[model samples]
Target: MPLFIRSVRLYPVNDNETFHRRFSVNVAVLGSLNLDVVFHCEALPIPGQTLLCDDFATGPGGKGLNQAVAARRAGAETSLLGAVGADASGDALLSFLKREDILTHGVVTLADAPTGVAHIVVDRDGENSIIVASGANRAVPADRLATAGLQALVWLAQLEMDIEVVGGFLREGRQAGARTILNAAPAIEAARSLFGDADLIIVNEHELAQFSGVPCPAGNDAAIEQAARKLMVRDDQILIVTLGAKGTQLVDSRSSFHVAAAPVVAVDTTGAGDCFCGVLAASLAQGASVPDAVRRANIAAGIAVGRTGAAPAMPLKDEIEAVSNG
Candidate 1:
């Protein structure tokens, strides 16, 4: 079956503000775009139980949006490719992106669906439980990717959208001489075959365990490296297993190393992983070495955890460097 691609240029209808930018797109992200509805609670409720919260907030989020914001704030020219509904939620998201100076030329509007949304509950510890209504995100046309001009750059992908498109984009981008980074969040079965196409695969401890069918090591770098290594089919492929608070470990064919997380008092851990991945992608796009980029990303994420929300909490390049240089 041939896929039909319908695209529209979403303008900043509600937001009447604009800023000038002097950079071109360096990183192109093809993933989910969502509006986040957040509830602040004492603790996450278990299944079959109900809890109430007093505080609530709504904002633009999703792995794609968060990463794109992180990349852009990290001083990389970034663009987003995803789908949204032709509704106010979608409009607000587009407007926010425009204000951030992110290129939205690839965001499609689905006339028949609502925009993707995430219902998130954050506890006092800054831990969260999320349930997503995929909506328009799942309906993205694979062919829409071709129009994004995603070649010859660092391409960012995630598991929030159609798996076929995720796999196809990685393959196409890599073949077009792009460095492909796959942030395998919400780890899925579809991601197994796509690893071959990714130059770098970023996953957390639990995701590593799920992918390798091994228990995530308890504070042991060797065990964590062993589990991460199982996912590497090629010698040159890199696997990054982000260990919360402890740091992130990078596994490659030749060797493995750990980048220590910067010391910080975390306030809200939401979007910390996305923060790391986005900053890493931006650093790499700017010609930073893998180790240096990872260090900067680690610091950026540490800074983000001290703040609140996802996209809004991302630190600018100056903020990250100030911490790095401090």
Candidate 2:
């Protein structure tokens, strides 16, 4: 049985200032918030090798924060449900979310754990390698959803926090009649158990391969589709495989199709995937069909890759509209 059975209506927004007030759709994000330390280098160093080049910068990021920013910019009434430390870094992150117009009432502050951090290195080609310290992200209580007062049309999450917490959040969203989307990123084996709770699952090729126990070679559409099919838990469960420059592949019980990527010069692919997931959830909340939502998300991700940083790179509603309509 499908969890959600509400009437879908598309709401178009012409003004960014009043977009949230004009639309009834709401998207709640359950994930991690991190302070990102980015180092630019000509190329990533091999094991046991020492190399340094280019520049270093810092910003507010994390899958949760990035997606929340993306969703707000993409024109959804967005709220972030996560935890951060009661430190200056956490304060800055919360302020950043508020500045982006995303609701932060659901974001809790914990005094024990410091804010989470991600050490990222970006190569010249925009490819990145990241190491994360969970910190306050893991401190988010599983029961927080019960008291969050979220009236969401869509519930989106990632794997940056505890797997059990993510599962609990998705389960609650399902019971609440909101469409749940699980971005099984940084692919973990524990996330497989939560698949049954998700209405839609998004993953990269490597994640698809990991969860499906199949070889999903890059750019191999046939292989990717075969892998995606193995993970579909219900007749209506939709699976989206993000293939970087190759674009997005969507698989469901009824049918499967590919949405071509937007052509652009890649500068930094740090938050491209997060951009895609956030915009896709926002579009779905706005009542766009699966295919249309995927197309919009693909375009947004393409725009993100052309810029630097994660949360900052996400395209605005007007920018996405201009490119998508063009």
Candidate 3:
């Protein structure tokens, strides 16, 4: 059966602000935190072989953490709800978030559960393979997250937790009258439950298939759009299929619109999708309809892909706006 969903407006996202309280957008992220250990290889070494890294760094990451920081940098007052180990990696992660200004009040610190860490290998061209040791993150016990008064609730989840936790959060957001957006990354079998509750399902070309079970475009945007239209409320709920340089195709309750990608020589595509979704959520909280928000997000993503590293690559609001206005 088709996922049960509600209708969403189709107009292009507008760049404006409408808040229940303040000027900035407010967003809550229900997800994980991780310390990213990167291996900068010219090319991935063969299995059972060793490849040396030319450069490396450790930083705060994981879809939830990346998206939260990106949203905050993009001008959203964001909060993160998840667990982290009390290790040195956890300390640095918290410190970095403090610098970025995301609400860390809700982070659960576990002494024994060592903070989650993702071992990543990225080739010179930015293609990557990652394995996550979801230490503290796996503590996703099934419970409804307390939803106070946030403009939106987002889930950048990995299926490291029970599906009940995901379901509980969605229900909590609905109860609190917040826009519920899910950035279902590393799409897993249980992640399927997200569609029914999401106001917007942000997907890359590969992830779109993982969710909709529909094959991504065999060739072009038209094929992809057709596939996306099959999932969720194609004409109602927001279905954004990001096409890298090809830009994005947004389908809503009425008609679909295509936003052209801004040109940039990509140094690292890591976290670009998270940047886009983060901006999209922030822009939506700022009262931007999908088109305007997504247009601006496309520009923001361009800025992120132009640099290296995950969190370090996200551009600030002014920088993103400058590129968007250009």
Candidate 4:
């Protein structure tokens, strides 16, 4: 039987928000929070070349912060579990998160560390290059993480944070019978094991090639499946390979399916992938099947690319429905 695809617009009435709230899966993001300073240029400059930028933008961005916000906007009862420096940026980040309704009870403050910061350069085509300083994000230790068995999902980004600590959460989350989801961005050597404990893994083309240990040539379906076949076994797990514009390839222990990308003239691709992960996780919490959830996530990401920054760029669930339902 074909997998049922739930309508991304399938949200219940306002009164139903309570049900979605009470019964909804709890999403806990164990990650980093950073301030992003973005520079928009008319094309990437070459080495030893000096070029003037056309625009500049700044937003709250970090794998940890972006994903957590994504989950919250996706309508999950989301919680942020991380650390930030007691600095000006941290103050602003908290204020923003509070407005989003994401619980920050677990976000610890470090006096010695500065808030993590990322300098991003977005080119004419909306592609970006980012340099990150982990700062206080690195200060979060295994001993500091608050234990929780009630969370339905625990998310982590390999923003140069310790993989062991993440693994421990997985081992513990399982003891609490929670789902473990990992977005292995900016690939790392230790990330190899992160997959073992996760129920889902989301990655882009470059990340897939490295993780699968194969030459994932830049192609459409064939290259995606060629790569997906190696990283995932049929039903053993699910792997989502994002193909910049061609859409996304989803592979699981059972099979792989391609969800075509929604058409949108992209301005900035920053935080789009993280947006996808957040929307996907939220849909799953709302009882969407994997394929259906991916469908919604694809639309959400498409909308994200059409905007600029990370937080301001993420559309509300209503906006996602409009795009997906279109």
- TM value for model 4: 0.87
Better by lDDT, candidate 4 or 1 = 1
For candidate 1, write residues 98-156 as lDDT tens digits. Answer: 99998886787878889999998889988888999999998877865433334336888
- For model 4, the stretches where C-alpha displacement exceeds 4 angstroms are 1-25, 153-160, 233-235
What is the alpha-carbon lDDT of model 1 when measured against the actual structure?
Answer: 0.85
Runs of candidate 3 with Cα error greater than 4 angstroms are: 1-25, 143-161, 233-235
Overall lDDT per candidate, in order of appearance: 0.85, 0.86, 0.74, 0.76
lDDT of 2 at 102: 86
TM-score of each: 0.91, 0.91, 0.85, 0.87
What stretches of model 2 exceed 4 Å from their correct place? 1-25, 144-148
**Error of model 2, residue 131, in angstroms:** 0.4
Residues 1-326, model 2: lDDT tens digits? 12432233333322322212222337889889999999999898789977787678889899999998999899888878788998999999988898898877667787799999999999999999999998999877675433234568899999998898898889888988999999999888888899999999999999999888989987888898888989988888999999998889998987778888978899999989999999999999888999999999999999999999999899999999999788
TM-score of 2: 0.91
Deviation of model 1 at 69, angstroms = 0.3
